[model samples]
Target: MQQSADILKLFEESAIAAGRVILDIYRAGAAVRLKGDTSPVTEADEAAERLILAALARHMPDVPVVAEEEVAAGRIPDVSGGRFILVDPLDGTREFIGGHDDFTVNIALIEAGTPVLGVVHAPALHTLYLGGAGKAEKVKLDDKDAVIARMPIAARLKGASPSALVSRSHNCDATDAYIRKAAILERKTVGSSLKFCMVAEGVADLYPRFSPTMEWDTAAGDAVLRAAGGMVATEDGAPLTYGKRLPGLRAFENPPFLATGRPSERG
Candidate 1:
């Protein structure tokens, strides 16, 4: 129990430190470039990743790290042991590039295909959300930071009018169809895992990713969402699992999944 709590503390600190580093860069605003995948990559992402990676290496050296920037740079970590760190130093790269304060630094610990701990920090917005060890909370991190919200798993909804949180960047036809058919009323276009955080905090309702996403993209968010009474599940209604050992599968490419706050509504 102590070890779990300690690891959770490390995860939280790493996320907040990464968020601070990213916020410094975001405030200054640097030149942005596109990665080979045509996704945005900034100096903030690189620097924050460097900071967080070093911290994780120092604190949890035995656990391998699978970071987005490192994968993009062709340095995939070995996850054969089925336990490792999943990270997106800057999740909303496009929003960061576009000068929107909607980006996030995301990290999660995946063990045997389950996210046991997760942390997400929105540096620009000065907010942080985390979950682990059967606990989930949201902190508003201004100059004087404070825990503004404690998240609880949502109860069954009264109506079928579930709320939906969609990507501000990657909305697609499939996503549109899900929203329409799902009878989503309150639609929020939040970037990065903040979309997931919304459901975790009971601010928004559901999140459906009809488009492609990698395991790392949602692992941390899923952990927090699940910890706070939500879930990320495969289309077949199975819970989303992570850190699978596929010899040739890419590091951060995610499959289509849904983040639903109301598990009871699945019928």
Candidate 2:
């Protein structure tokens, strides 16, 4: 895209479009299956991913797409240039299948191993978060998914009584210890990348994820959080970068990390 605005519009539209398809399938009660990794998958995931891939192909022909379902199907594109789009058409398959509203459609642009733009859309909740070009925003949608309101958002500086956001589907002792060690005064359970959006909106101050996650699962939310003046860092306080392929590890695998609404020196 020539401008950041163009990228933002495309990301937002593409995410929302995929979300619409997901909702349609969700309403009809989709059948569930398992991927090679034993994680759950549904028709909504496949259908939404297909819709997102097509949209990206049409609008961002030059950019490579590393989408979840596509990767599972051995359809990975060449992202050697360090610039590509990461997509999780349905970020919270379990939540969706469980009839919860925490699932989302996620899209992000990674440049030089860092996300510069991102969009997260929750169709069931009619909520969206966009981040890029030094701006981060939360959008409210109507029943038909039309934008009803938009507000600028930014991360709040950490304070003494910081709150934490934890995952509903994947809970671990490591995360709990981190929260306890940090002395987090409050905690909330969330699914999908909505945890990152909540931090971006200043609703929470921290999100510590110790569970295994792929790049697509976190890229979009990471972008939004970063754009909102927040930070995603490894345990050592280093900025979390994408395009990772450590030896003996799966491609796009991520290390345990912490998410916070603090000023990121790396940014």
Candidate 3:
């Protein structure tokens, strides 16, 4: 097994490289195309995925990679060993296309069905989150994608009237209803895996997603959150596991999950 520091560094470098590619496309106003599922894809997504996949192949050839654009193009690899890397080269594609700054590049290492290391970089926002080796931290990035400053981060224990983070683009009535039922003190709508990072950094208390999400969408942020003393669980209160596959179907799909900074409270 690779040392946690090595894995974390690899993930950070891959995410930053991918983030640079994404920002270049964002500035150029990338053209969007629809996939078979009707989800929007952009040049930024493909370019970033290629960059990340190449970096991983060079540094960690023994590990498999399950990347978004590749899988969408029918490049599925065998993940039966439950160890691999997950990449969402450009998560929140809709947000990116809409010119929102919440999109991110996510890279994660999954071992035996658990996310062991992760790095999430928001190029437009100039923010990055890293988690692994029993620690998590948030960093400020420069325009050139260099780290300016960083501070360790952890989830805050929930108090009375906790806040919640929800998807700004994919918001549904079911989520709103859940927030109401939880007696949430506040609700903030943001895009991409940043929701998970928010809880990890104590910016928010809870993030519940009742809508559809793939594992790549959540794994990296889930790793960061878990490393920061948070938890991501299914509706049945089970921790979300990776390397999931259906018989003769798509692999690494995810079920509805709830992420919380404070497992003790329901908000």
Candidate 2 C-alpha lDDT tens digits along 1-267: 468899889889988988889999999999999999999999999988888889888888999999999899999988999999999999989999999999999999999999999999999999999999889999999999888999999998877688899999998999999888877779999999999999999988889999888999999999999999888998788889899887766899988998889774222
Per-residue lDDT for 1-267 in model 1, tens only? 237678877877888888887877887877788889888889988998999999998888889899988988999888978889899998988888888888888899988888989998888777888887888878776554445554444423425566788899999999999888867677888788888888887767678898767777888888888888778887888888886633555545556788877566565
Clashing pairs in 1: 153-228, 153-229, 213-254, 214-253, 214-254
Q: Which scores better on TM-score, 1 or 2?
A: 2
Give me the candidate number with maximum lDDT: 2
The 10-residue segment with the lowest total lDDT in model 1: 150-159
RMSD of each: 2.3, 1.8, 1.6
Question: Model 2: how far is 121 from its true place, Å?
Answer: 0.3
Q: For each candidate, what TM-score against the reference?
A: 0.92, 0.97, 0.96
lDDT of 1 at 214: 76
Q: Tell me the number of clashing residue pairs for each predicted model.
A: 5, 0, 0
Better model by lDDT: candidate 1 vs candidate 3: 3
Q: Which residues of candidate 2, in runs, are more than 4 Å off? A: 264-267
